[model samples]
Target: MTDFTGSMGYCEFQIPFFIEGVRVETSQMLVGTEYHEEAEKIDRETAIVMPLTKTKLQDKKEDLNFVREDIQTSFVQEFDFPECKATLSLFGRADKVVRKKETLIVSDDKHVSNPRRYDVMSEPYVGQLLQVLAYLNSKYYLGESFGGWKEIPCSTKMYQINIVDSKTRSIYKTYEEIITEEHAELFLDYTSKFIKKCLELDSLDHHNSKPKCKACGYFSDCSHALK
Candidate 1:
């Protein structure tokens, strides 16, 4: 259906290239001295797919043809993963509604701040986010409204949660079917380490990240490029 990769309120880039004059496409070769380096590179990718109907596919194509636009109205949903943990994540635009009008609460901090939670360099949270999404996909599909909230509350707090499974490996079945807890103890340890690693990476990214030019047309002023 509709294919998208988003950073929401962050660096969003799209590359459109013609497939012409290309008979084949392949990934780059990994370079490393140690055998473990090659092994690490093997886990660099995870594949996930969704079921789509003809109508949904057409709608997604229309949304993608010109530009990819994100949903402005925020939504929240509480998730109960396979691990028996109940947690929630926020979705929607930064400029969109923050506190729900009637209820007036910020139930999820991730929704209001709109930062990259699952950093590429982070340890556990990155994989955890993937694992959680994959688990959710197995049980249900993404719905239009916030599944967790009847009305977004007035005050919201932040809490971090991690998801892991040993039965699922990229080398085996697809991501959707693989998010299961086979080795809970080991997965928890690795994922926890990954979380701290990603936090440090986030701090570095914040300091070094640059804003777009002031003269750019897509943005109003350079000062507003998300500091």
Candidate 2:
């Protein structure tokens, strides 16, 4: 129930505004973009174990090179829609880049307490899927921009690894979700819709009330706060 317009993360879409003489920072006019800083805080033990585990995994898998070593740790991508004179910005980093035969695989590694494959159609993983899609799509645009662009078949996937523990050290799962042309189109549609909605909301004097308002910092001052 959190307000999307105010939430902050790796990818954010906001509309800046002024309300009752106060300037709102998250308005559509200014979509706040953030990165690595907001990443989940892992415990000391997990942080220590992560690299060892990753190295072991890498040693076991051939022809796999963590993208961390090949490219910048993080990057930002943006596209402007000339059709409507609107712009979309995205920022994220892929976990791994692997070359298998002729196909390139762009993958994301996720560590979860109870690892399991997620349905691409579900909401919980939409943001994650969008991230991978952005990575794959960005490569195409980048190739075009840089030239020497040899079109190659590539795919995006994710690996949901179980948390590392004594009982799970030998057990983990890899999940791969295909990012197709349809998903890319869907992302564009949603992004455009989100931008339009954010701008529309920015022009309003009030927002609809929801349960999450109780925890929002602006609750007391919000005109739409429930009584």
Candidate 3:
């Protein structure tokens, strides 16, 4: 159980949210930089749930149409506008890739105790949509061994499989995201600005927002946090 506020590495998922959190935590070098051992326990627990969910999903893959798991992907490309000339290295791993005949469904599992609180169409889980699209847009984010994988599905759609704790309740069920080209393009545009903003960061810049603070692990030490 590693418990600490680690520095941000370039990750392909939830780019904006992670950037914002880092900016806040890094604002006051004196206080925020110190690692809060207790804060990361929740994150560790969350991470632990992933492998368990993946194992369960793996068992049902054939029936659920999952094609692959833990697929590694990386790419370097220049962006448009403010991010121009900057070659960003995007890297990530997709938890599962489901085959739906011709269209490929790239799915990432999000485990929560009370998943009913997060509606797929709401803002809370919107980042999941963005992250999953990154995997799909990068052509399923799979290695060359999956060369037979079709590109059409990659361009067309993706998914997010929300695994809620069924034992906690009677009606808790998993939700799925149906990502489209519009969703992908919107997130890509956001990524462009995200890259530019990240490059421009010198000192930590913090935002005055309540909801973000609630979700931030470093909020207790963040002097600029509203909460």
Among the numbered candidates, top TM-score falls to 3
Among all windows of ten consecutive residues in candidate 2, which has the lowest summed lDDT? 28-37
lDDT winner = 3
- Estimate, for each residue in 1-227, the C-alpha lDDT of model 1 and write its tens digit: 00011121122221011112212111211111222243334423331223433343224222111011111232233433343433233233211122222222111111111123334433332333433332222222224443422232223212123221222311211111223354344434433333232232222122124443221232332233443
Model 1 C-alpha lDDT versus the unseen true structure = 0.25
Query: Between the candidate structures 1 and 2, which one is better when assessed by TM-score?
Result: 2
Residue ranges of candidate 3 with Cα displaced over 4 Å: 1-68, 82-84, 119-124, 140-155, 166-178, 201-208
The local lDDT score (0 to 100) that residue 8 gets in candidate 3 is 25
Q: TM-scores, in order shown?
A: 0.19, 0.45, 0.56
Query: Which 10 consecutive positions of candidate 3 have the poorest summed lDDT?
Result: 1-10
| Count of backbone collisions within predicted model 2 | 7
Encode model 2's per-residue lDDT on 1-227: one tens digit a residue: 01222322111222232212334333321211111122222222233332223333224232334323233222233445444455544444444455453345665443333344333323335545555555555542222233422223333333332222222432344445555668769666655555555445323233344654554445566555655
Quote the lDDT for 91 in model 3.
65
| Better candidate by lDDT, 1 or 2 | 2
Candidate 2 lands at a TM-score of 0.45
User: How well does candidate 2 score on lDDT at residue 44?
Assistant: 25
